[model samples]
Target chain A: MTPISFPDPDFIARQTAKMLLEVKAVHFRSDEPYKLTSGLVSPVYIDCRRLISYPRLRAALMDFATATILRQVGFESLDAVAGGETAGIPFAAWIAERMGLPMQYVRKKPKGFGRDAQIEGVLSEGDRVLLVEDLTTDGGSKVKFAEALRTAGANVTDAIVIFFYDIFPDTREALAKHDLRLHYLATWRDVLAAAREGNHFPPETLAAVEEFLNDPLAWSGANGGVDRISV
Target chain B: MFDQLLECLNEQGAGVRAYDACARMARARVSEEPDNAAAYLLLAYVAQRFVESYDDQPLSVEAASEEFQQFTDIVKMLDKAEADASADARIAALNVVAAKLNTAPKTGD
Candidate 1:
């Protein structure tokens, strides 16, 4: 792999956030919060999958992803790349080709009669697999995919995503319990920073988003959304 | 022996060494009992993985078609095993079938 210069994580985060904003992938609605599957109601929402539609933007982000992984985890550390089912598949495909490693995808559920049923693609017993996803809300899906990969005999210690909803306070602790380190290009905080700098949203809307980010469940409760994230 | 393989297979970070162990054990079971549908299913699962590993390759049209045919063959083997395999094995085989269907080549591809 060609050597890549490491940019400050903050810079990458802000740039990624700006790109998301540019693509109109981030939505902020404080008055009527969007209900998350986890049950938390929020005034902020983002769809990282939109990045895939813009080839140039996606390529730049992929470069940032490869650089981030190489800098944080080392270039030679990974044996293969695995995307988390649907959304993660394209990103993983690009990254795996760039890194010249085999690629696989993890299904949400098992497909066949063996331990490796949940995994699609050839993963060796000691293959150091890097799990990729589009975005993480509360880090729940990562844990599930990582467990499935582990069940299939792949060593999964690291997972990366394009966006992370850093609103939840316990996401890191939850993933750490599974021995899966989480990496991402940007988060709600970074997006908020970009919005503030760019004046992307009305001040009130931005303030509402910040309030929701600071205490999501509380905001959810006040806004007629679930007070606590279920399970 | 199957239980041990399952444990290793399910264990986090077991890696290629663990998968190899499982494959070997599965093959051994098939050798001992050629009629064992479960063993055949396991082998099919392994074969599916092997086929998927080639997805990143820049295959020529002919190569891609060949690979797709191989994948279809594996899915067929798993379906054949499903009739005689245990309930767990049947579920597993079906899952593989579903995954294969999702990626199966379109007509004329």
Candidate 2:
């Protein structure tokens, strides 16, 4: 498919947000905050893992992801697709199929001895790897996975995630610092807009979520969560 | 193991021929009792041809995974056999293909 034939980015974002909500991937609660892995308490919690459970939604999401990557990165740019650990595995698998490229998964830690320790599946040295994951929060995990791919002799310059936190300022910079381009289908802002437009939650809850999104560290600090994000 | 992987890769590289072979093998194996893992692995190896030969219209990863699991089971069974070195090497090659297939993407879609 040609790049322009793809759905508009704005439209994709809105629809992706709606799909996430429809599948109950996004949860909003003001009274009881959800604790993040980073130890941040927030009114909104998103579990992209749920995306794998819905076939229709998963297909649409993969289409959007495939389109975005194709638009941002050339269709022939990638040689292989690598999924990070458990959660990223399925998404990576889908992307690899869409791209019709060989697929592999990177373990969080080395599986055995040698340089290819963290890698599973056959990875040709110097082959370009497009890392895939379900979502990115601080983007830390993607960086870690990309590094592993690089260490295993993969030229990992691009990564795709179904969702990106988009709240953290350093997320993109951290990715760029590692020479990785991050491609995502939807983000926190997109979810927030969809939530507001759909009235998925109370106005106050949406506002609180918006506030948390606007200044997450400050909001988390005030809300009895970690103020500083450890690199 | 490398030789079989190369064979699978060659079959994938062969385009329509691989697809026809895989389709024929898949149908043939369907009538067999309990399904042979080798048959499934062969199907998956051939399915990669359809995936590669065609563009945009993606093969169902679910279909790919079924053959992949079959291939993996065959490898596991061979590993348990504790056969001679040549048989073990042959199993090893098949397992490489199986491992590749086992990681085949799941659409869940």
Show model 1 residue runs off by greater than 4 Å.
A1-3, B1-109
**Where does the lowest 10-residue lDDT sum fall in candidate 2 chain B?**
B54-63
Consecutive 10-residue window with the lowest summed lDDT within model 1 chain A: A222-231
The residue-by-residue lDDT of candidate 2 on A71-135, one tens digit each, is 89988898998998878899889878887889999997787898899999999999999999888
Q: What is the lDDT of residue B59 in candidate 1?
A: 22
Q: Indicate the residue-level lDDT of A95 in model 2.
A: 78
In angstroms, the error of model 2 at B93 is 52
* Tens-digit lDDT track of model 1 for B1-109: 2344445333311222233444566666676766554544555455335334432112232343353355445546555655655767766765665576558543332
lDDT tens readout by residue for model 2, B13-85: 2223234444555545446523245634554554544444331122223333343345445435444443444
- Rate residue A219 of model 2 by lDDT: 83
For residues A19-131, write the lDDT of model 1, one tens digit per residue. Answer: 99999998887765554545455677777778889999998898889988898888899999999987899999999988889999999768978999998899999799999
Per-residue error for A86 in candidate 1, Å, reads: 1.0
Whole-model lDDT per candidate: 0.73, 0.71
